[model samples]
Target chain A: MRAVVWIAEGSWQACVDQARAILPPDTAVTLLHVAPGDVEALAEGARRGLFGRHPPPPPPHGSIREISDAEAGRLLATARERLGRECETMARRGRVEREVIAACAQADADVLVLARDGERKLGPPSLGHHPRFVVDHAPCTVVLAWAQAPPAVETIPPPPRHRP
Target chain B: MSEVVALLALALALAASVARVRFAPDWAVAVAGALVLLAVGAIGLTGVGHALTRFGPTVGFLAALLVLGDGCRRAGLFDALASVMASFSHGSARRLLAIVFAVAAATTAVLSLDATVVLLTPIVFATASRLQLGSRAPMYACTHLANTASLLLPVSNLTNLLAFQAARLPFARFAALMALPWLTGLAIEWLVLRLAFRAELDVAAPQDAQADADAERRPLPRFALALLALTLAGFVASSTLGVAPVWVAVIAAAAITIGVRPRPAELVAAAQPAFLAFVLALAVIVAAAGAHGLSSAVDALLPHGDGLLALLAVAGVAAALANLANNLPATLIILPLVSASGPGPVLAMLVGVNIGPNLTYVGSLATLLWRRIVHAHDETVDIAEFTRLGALTVLPALVACTAAVWLATQVT
Candidate 1:
C-alpha cells in the first residue's frame, strides 16, 4: 500500500508515529513537508520596495531563500529520523494545504496521514484552516492524528440556553 | 456636483485599494483613479503637469534615498550593524531590546523608516531567534521605532519630506525643531513597549554558540557606512550650499550606485517607478480635490494659530484622518491646509502622522509592510494585540510630541 505522511513543523512527530503504527511494514511511505513561501515573498518584497528594480548584493551569510531551504531540510531530516524507516522525503513550497493535497495525489497514495496543527480544542477549529481544507479535499483515506492527547469533554463549552 | 461626487468616489476607491484590496498594486489603483478624475474633467491636463512639476523634487528625493538604502543593504551594512548589536547584548534580552531601539532609531533617522522596516526588521528577527530571546519584543521595537524614530529628520519619512518642503524650513532648522519631539516620542514608545512586552523581554537570553560564532564572522561594510554618514552630512550642508536636498540625495545615490556597480536592472528596481508613479498620481488627485471644494472643507475644520491647544487640535485631527485613510494621503491633504499656519502646526501634523500609524495596520504603509515581514517569519501580531499596544503608546507619544513642538516654537 502507498501512503503519504504530511509533515509539518510542530506536529510532524505525531503524524510519523501514527503512520508507523498503522501502516504495514512493507508500505511505500513518502514524507511530505510544505514550506510556506512567505520567507521568499518577504525577501522579494523588501527587494522591490526598498531597492530600486535591481537585485541587492548577496547577504553576508546567505540569501533568505537559501536559509529557508536549509531550515526546511533540517525539519524534514528530523521527521525522517523519527519515522525510523526508509521513505521518500519531499519538500515543496507555497500554500500549505494545496501542496499537501497535491503531494498525496502525485504519490497515488491509498492513505494520507497528518496531525492537527491548530488549537488543541474540542471543535472544528482543532483542525485549523489548512488541515480542515485538506481533510475535505484529499482523494484517499485520511487518518487524522492529534499532536497531543485530545482535550477532555469538559473543555467543550455548554450549549447556549434560549430564554423561555 | 458630478465632479465632487466623482472625486469622492475616487477617494473611497483609493482608500479601499490601499487598505483592503489586493488584486492590483496601490500604484495601479491610484493611477486609475487619477485617470478617472482627468476623464471627468475634474482636473485638466495642466493640473497633472503642475503636480508632476511641484512634486518632482520630492519624488526624486524619495527615489534617491531608496537607492542609497538599497546600496547599504546590499553591502551588508544593516546586517553587520544588527550582528554587532546582538553581540553587545551579551545574552541579555533586555539589553538586546535596548540595543535594537538605539540601532533602529539611528537607522530610521538616517536611512528612512522604509529602510528600518524592509532591511533591519528581518535581521532583527533572525538575531533574536538565534539568541533564543524570543523575537516578539525586539521585532516590535524595530517596527515601532521605524515610525516614531522617523520624526527626527526630513529624510526620515516621506511625510516629513512633504512637510519640510511645504514649510521651507532650512534642513538644520527643521532638525533642530524636531529633535525634542523626536526624542520625546521615542522615549515614550520605548517605555510603553518594554512594559507591554515585559514577558518576552524578562527572559534570559541563552547563549547560542553558533549564533555567537556567526555574529563574529560577518564583516562590517565600512564603505557603505561611510557613504551613509556622508549623505546625512550632505543633507545638512545642502541648505547652506544653496541647493535643494533632492540634489544632495541624487548625487549621493549616484555615488553609491557607482560604488556598488549593480546591474542596470537592479538599479531600475531600486528606483521603484511604481511607487514614484503612485506618489505623483496621488498628488494629482489630491491637487484636483483641493481645487474642487475639498480644500475649503478641510480648511474649515483645521485649527488656526500656533498655540499649544491649536497644535494639539491639528495633530489630533491629523491622527484621526491618518487612521481613516492612509498616512501618505493624509499628509497630502493636510499639508496644504496647515502650511499657512506656520512651522509649529506643520511639524505638529508631522508628529501625528508619523507616530499615529502605530495605532492600526492600515494607518501607514510601513506598518502594513512590517506586518507582512512579521508574518513571513512565522509570527503573528493580531489586530487586537496591535491596537492594544498602539493605544498604550500613540496617545502619550502624540500629546508629548505635540507639546514638545509647541514648546520649541515658543522658545525660538
Candidate 2:
C-alpha cells in the first residue's frame, strides 16, 4: 500500500508517529511538507505597500522564500528522523491544503495521513479549516491523528438554552 | 449634483479598494479612482497639476525615505540592532520587552513607522523566537510603537509628512512641539502593553547557546548608522538653510543606495513609483472631493478654535475619520480644513490620526501590514485579543497625546 503523510508545523510528530504505529511495515510512504506561500505574500505585501511594484534588495541573512523553504526542509528532516524509515520526502509550496491534496494525488497513494491542527475539543473545529478541507476533499482513505492528547469530553460547551 | 454623486461614489470605491482589494496594489486602486474623477470632470487637469505641485515634496520625501530604509535593511542595520537588543535582554523576557520598546520607539522616530512595521517587526519576532522568549510582548511593542512613536518627527509617518507640510513648521520646531506628546504616548503604550501581555512578559528566558553565539557574531552596520545620523542632521539644517527637506532625503537615499550597490530591480523598488503615483493620485482625488461639497461637510463639523476642548474635539473627529477611512485618506480629507485653523488644530489632528489606528485593523495601512508580517512568522493574533488590547491602549494614548499637543501649543 502507498501512503502519503502530511507533515505540518507543530503537528508533524503526531502524524508521523501514528503512521509508524498503524501503517503496514512495507507501505511506501512519502512525507509531504507544504511551505505555505503566505509568508512570501506577506513579505511582498510589505514591499508593495511601501514601494509599490519595486522589489527590495534581498535581505543579508536570507529572503523570506529562502528561509521558509529551509524551514520546511528542516521540519521534513526532523519528521523523517522520527519516522525511522526509508521514505520519500517531498517539499511543495503554495496554499497548504491545496498543496497537500496535490501531493497525495501525485504520489498515487491509497491512504492519506494527517493530524488535526486546530481546536483540541470535540467538535467540527477540532480539524482546522485547512486540515478539515483536506480530510473532506482528499481522493483517498483519510487517517486522522490528534496533534496532542484529546481534551476531556466536558470541554465542549453546553447547547444554548431554548426560549419558551 | 451629479458631480457630487460621482465624487461620493469614487470615495466609497476607494475606501472599499483600500480595505478589501487584495488582487491589485493600493496605488493601482488609488490611480483608478483618480481616473474616474477625471473621466467625470470632477477635477480638471489644472486642478490635478495643482494637487501634484502641493504634495510633490511629501511624495518625494516619502520615496527617498523608503529607499534609505531599504538600504539600511540590506546592510543589516535592523538585524544588528535586534542582536544588540537580544544581548541586552540577558535572558529575561521583561528586559527584552523593555529593550523592544526603546528600540521600536527610536526606530519609528528616526526611520519612519514603515521601517518599524516592515523591517523591525520581523527581526524582533525572530529574535524573540531564537531566545525562546514570548513573542507577544516584543511583537506588539513593534507594531504599537510604529503608530504612537511616530509623533516625534515630521518624517516619522506619512500622515505626519502631510501635516508638516500644511503646518509649515520648521523641522526642529516640529520635533520640539511633538516631543512631549511622543514621550507620553510611548509611556502609555508601554504600560498598557505590559498589563495586557503580563503572562507573556513574565516568562523566564531559556539559555540558548546557539542564539548567544549568533548574536555575538552579528556585525553592526556602521556606515548605515552614520548615514542615518547625517540624514537627520540634514533634516534639521534644511529649515535654516531655506531648502526643503526632500533634498536632504534624496541625497541621503542616493548615498545609501550607492553604498549598498543595489541591483537595478532593488533600485526601482526603492524609488517606489507606484506608491508615489498613488500619493499623487490620492492628492488629486482628495482635492477634487474637497472642492465638491466634501470640504463643506467637513468644515461644518469641525471645531472652531485651538482651545483645549476644541483641539480634543478635532482630534476625536480625526480619529473617527481615520478608523472610518484609512489614515492616509483621512489625513488628506482633514488636513485642509484643519490647516485653515492654524498649526494647533493641524498638530492636534495629527495626534488623533497617528494614535487612533491602534483601535482597529482598518484604522491604518501600517497596522494591516503589521498583522501580515506577524502571521508570516507563524504567529497568530486573535482578533478579540487584538481589539481588547487596542481598546485598552488607544483612548488613553489619544487623550494624553492630544492634551500634550494642546499644552505644547500654549507654551511654544
Candidate 3:
C-alpha cells in the first residue's frame, strides 16, 4: 500500500501507529507537514511595530519558514521510527489547505490519513479551518483519525481507498 | 444611559476580539466598536480627534522602533548576539542557562519583547540543538525573560510605552523608577528557572568550541549597534530637550532602512495597521466606559495610601484584570482610571500588567506568541506544567517587582 499521512505540530502518535498496523508490511508512506507562514506570528511582528513612528520591516522572509521546516524534519523522524521504515518526508511553506491538497495529488497515494479534528497541544479537539478543507477537497480516500488512544490492532479496519 | 449602552457595545467588541470566530480579525471588531460609538454619539468626532492628538506621537514612536528592530534583525544583529551567547555556554547546560537569561533579558529590554519572541527564540533552540542540551530550560527562559525584563525601558514593552506616554514621564524618569523593579524581576525569574529546570541543566556536555569559533567569525553588526546606541541616546536627549521620542525613533528607523534597503512591502507588512486601529478603537471604548461609570468603579477600588501595601493592592488588581482580557486591553482600560492618581499608581499598574502575563499564556500577547514559537520547534508545552512553573515563579516576581517600584517611587 502507498499512503500519505498528514501531520501537524500537535498530532497524536496513535494516528500514526494505528495506521501503520493496518497497512501492508511493505507499504510506502509519505509524511507531509505544511507550515503556512503563520498569520498569527506575522500579526505579532506587526503588533510590535505598532507602537513605533515608522513601520516595522516585514518578518525576515523565511525566518519562520526555516524554523517550520526544521521542526517538520524532527516530527517526521519520530513518525519514521514508529512506522519502522523509511518514509518520504516533504516540508513546504504556503497556505495549509492548498499545500495539503497539492501534496496529495503529487504523492498520488492510495489513501490519506489525518486527524479529523485538528490536534491542539493540550485542549479538546480543535476542528480547525484546515481539516474541513482537507476533507472537502482531498484528491484521494481520506481517513479521519480520532484522538483517542490506540484501539486494538485486530479491531482496526483496513485502510480505506475511496479516491475523490 | 448612553454610557451604559456604550459599555455593552464595548463588552461585545472585546468578546469578539478574543473569540475564535471566523468572521473577522480582532482588530476589525475593535474598529467596528469605535465606529459604533461615534454613530451612537457615545463618543463624538471631537473625542476621536482628541484620542489621536493625545496618542499620535506614541504611536509614531512605536512604529519607528518596529522598523529599526526589523532592520537590525535583517542585518543579522540578533543572530550575531545569539551566537555570542551560545559561545559562553562553555559546554555546560548550567552556564548556558545563565547566558541565555542574560541574553534574553538584554534583547527584551533593547529590541522589545516581540523581537525577543520572533527573533531570539529560534536562536536559543538552535544553539541548544548544536550543544545537545535539553531545549526546555532555554525555551522557558526566553519566554519568561521576554515579559519580566521588558520592565526596564519604555521601548521594552508596549504597555510601558502606553503608560509612559500617558503619564508624560521623562525617559530618564521612567528608567530610573523601573531599574530596581526590573532587576528584582529578572533575579526572581532566573532563580526560579534554575530551580525548576535543575534536573535538565545538570547534564554534562561536550564542548563544541569549533562551532562557537565559527559563529564568532561572522561579520559584526557594528552599523546596527551604532544605530541602536544613537537611537537610545536620542531618546534621552529628546526627553531633555522636550522633544517627542518619536522624532528620534523615526530618524533612526529611516537610517537603518536606508542601510538595509528592505522592500517597502516588508516595511508596511510589519507596521500592522490593524493593531494600530485596535489601539485607537480600544481607547474609544475605554473613553465610553469612563462616561458610563467604569472609571469611578476603578477609582473606588483604589487604595487610599501611597504606602507599600497600597502599591501591592493596585498591582494585584491590575494583574487580575490583565489575566482576564490579556494585558494590552487591560492596560488600556486601567490607564484612564489610574491616570488621575499620579505616576506612582500608573507605574505600579505597568508593573502589574507587564509581569502579570507571566502567570498564563493568555495574560499577554507576547506569551501567546511564545506558545506559537514553541510549537514551531516541535515541542509541546503542557498547560498544567506551565501553570505549575508559573505559580512558583511569576507570583514571587510580581510581588518583588511591584514592591521595588513602590520603593523607587518613595526615594525618587
Candidate 4:
C-alpha cells in the first residue's frame, strides 16, 4: 500500500521517523511538509507556547521557490534528514491542508498516515485545525499517529464560591 | 413585580431552549424552532417599519445578488473556475489554497457575502472531490474567508452598506482603507487554518491537463441572464433609489418564481435555514434594542472626536458585540448609536464589526451559512471551536484592525 505522511511543525517528522521504523519494509512511504507562509511565524512560535521552528526550503523543483532566510533553510534540512530509502520528501509550498489533499490526489496513495504527537487516542482525535480539517475532508483512509497515551491530566484547585 | 416575572419567563425560555439543543443534539431542529419564534415576533409584535429598516438594505442586496449569483451558478462560472483550479493540480496544495483564498476574497468583495457562501460551497465541494480530496477543510476556509472578504467593500456586504450609508463614504475611500485590513484579516485567517492543516497538505501527482467537461461548462440561457439583471436592478434600486428593500426583494423573488420555472422545492432549498437566523437576528436585536439601550445610550454620551482611546474602545466593543450578536442586526442596532457619535466613529465601527464576524460562526450571515454547508462534509464547526480558534485568529485580527483604525483617525 502506498502511504503518504503529512509533515507538520514541532516533532511531526520525528514521529514519522518512528512510524517509518515500524512500517513493513515493502510499504512505500511519502513524507509531506507544507511550509508556513512566512518563516517568521515558525521562528517566533516558541514564545507563544508552541515549539518547532524551521525556515522554508528553497522552492521545490518544478514549483516556485522564493528565497527564505537562513533559518528556514536550516530547519528544512534538519527536518528532511529523517527520510529513509523507503520514504521520499515533498516540501510543499503554501498552506498545510490544501497541500496534503493535493498530494494525496497526485500520489494516488492508498492510505494516508498523518503523523503528529499528542493525538494517538483510540477514540475521536483532538486534532489541531490542519489535521482536523484533513480528517474531516481527505478522501483516502487516514491513520493518524498521535501519542500512545494522552498526557496525564493534572488537577487544579477549584474556584472559590461567590458570596451572593 | 410584573417586570421581574416577565424577565424570569424570558430567561427560563431561553435556558430551556438552550438545554434542549444540548440534550437532543438536534441543532437543525433547535435553530428552526428558534427562527420560527423570532420571525413571528418580528412580523406580529415588532413594528414592521423597524425590522424592515434594519434589514431592508441587506434583504434588497441579497435578493439582487441571489438572482445574479444564481445566474452565475447556472452559467457554470464557479464550475469553470474549478476547472481552472483543477488545471493547476500539478502545483502544490499551498498554491491551490492561495488561489482559493485570493479568489474567494476578490469574488466576495464584489458579490454579496451570502452569495459567496452559496456559490463557493458547491464548487469547493466539487473541486475537492475532483481532486480526490474530501474534507471539511475546504468548506471551512471557503466559507469563513468568503465572509471575511465580503466585509472589505461597501458593495460587497450588508455591514459595509450600513457603514457606507452612515459615513457618506465615497466608494474609493472605503476601498482604500478597509482593503488593507481586509487583506490582512484574510491572510491571518488563512495562515491560522493553514497552520492547523500543515501535515495534510503534502501530496504529489502531476495534475492532468484534461479539463473535466462538466467542471468547465454549464448551459445558461439568455433569459436567465436577463432575469438576473432585472433582479439585480431591483436590488440596486431599493438601495440607491430610495424604494423599499422588501418590496424590491419580494418582487424579484416573485418574478423569478414566475419566470425561471425552477422547482418550488429548489427555491425553498436555495432560501436556506440561515435566512431564518438572519430574520431572527432582525427581531431579537430590535427587541434587545428596546431593552438594553446600552450602545445607543453610550453613543449619546460620547462626543465623536479625535479622542483616540474612546474611538478604539467603542470600535472594540462594537466588534465584540457584533460577533456576540450577529453582524447584520448588530450593525443595525449600533447604526444609530454610531451616527450619534460622528463620521469617524461610524467608519471605524463598521470596519471593526463587519470583519469581526469572522471570529465566530455565529458572527455573520456567511459564517452561519457556512455552518449549514460544512455539515455536508460530515465535519462540523461549533461555537466553542470558533471561540477557541478565533482567539488565535479572529481576536488578534480584531485587535490589529481596531488599532489600525484608531491610528488612522489621527491621520484621516
Count of residue pairs whose backbone atoms collide, per candidate: 9, 1, 14, 19
Q: List, for all models, the DockQ compared with the true complex.
A: 0.05, 0.08, 0.04, 0.03
Instruction: For candidate 1, write residues A71-164 as lDDT tens digits.
Output: 5676677678888998999988776788888999999999999988654445665666678999999999999998777677788787789875
List the RMSD of every prediction in angstroms: 8.7, 8.2, 11.7, 15.3
Predicted complex 2: DockQ: 0.08
Best by DockQ: 2
Sort by TM-score, best first: what order?
2, 1, 3, 4
Residues B34-60, model 2: lDDT tens digits: 887888788889988899889998988
The estimated TM-scores of all candidates read: 0.72, 0.73, 0.72, 0.55
Write candidate 3's Cα lDDT for B1-412 as tens digits: 6787778866766665554356766677777877888888888888888887777777777778777878888899877876676667766678888898988898899888878776777777666645545456787788778888999999998888889989888888898999999999988888888877654565434333326434564565999999898888888788778888878888998999999998888887666566677777777777777767877787688685567888888888888877666777678778877777777888888888888877764444444554466467632223555567668877888788889988899899
TM-score winner, 3 or 4:
3
TM-score of chain B of each: 0.92, 0.93, 0.92, 0.67
Tell me the deviation in Å of residue B404 in model 2.
Answer: 0.4
**Model 1: CA > 4 A from native:** A1-164, B5-9, B12-16, B19-23, B210-216, B362-381
* Candidate 4 per-residue C-alpha lDDT over A3-92 given as tens digits, one digit per residue, 9 for 90 to 100: 787755444554566557666778777776665432212111111110000111111111112222222343344445655555666666
Compute the lDDT of residue B283 as modeled in candidate 3: 78
DockQ for candidate 3, please give it.
0.04
Compose the digit string of candidate 1's lDDT tens values, residues B1-412. Answer: 6457546745654654444345766677778888888888888999889888888889889999989998887787877886687787777678889999999999999999888877787787666655555455776777778888999999999999988988999998899999999999988988898877654454454334335635465678988888878888888988889988888889889988988887999888887787788888889889988888877787788889999999998899888777656677778888989998899999999988888877764454543655565566543223555568788889999999999999988887
Candidate 4: list runs displaced more than 4 Å: A1-164, B1-58, B133-137, B166-173, B206-288, B291-307, B361-388, B406-412
Worst 10 residues of 1 chain B by lDDT: B377-386
Task: For candidate 1, give the lDDT of residue B194.
Answer: 83
Ranking by lDDT: 2, 1, 3, 4
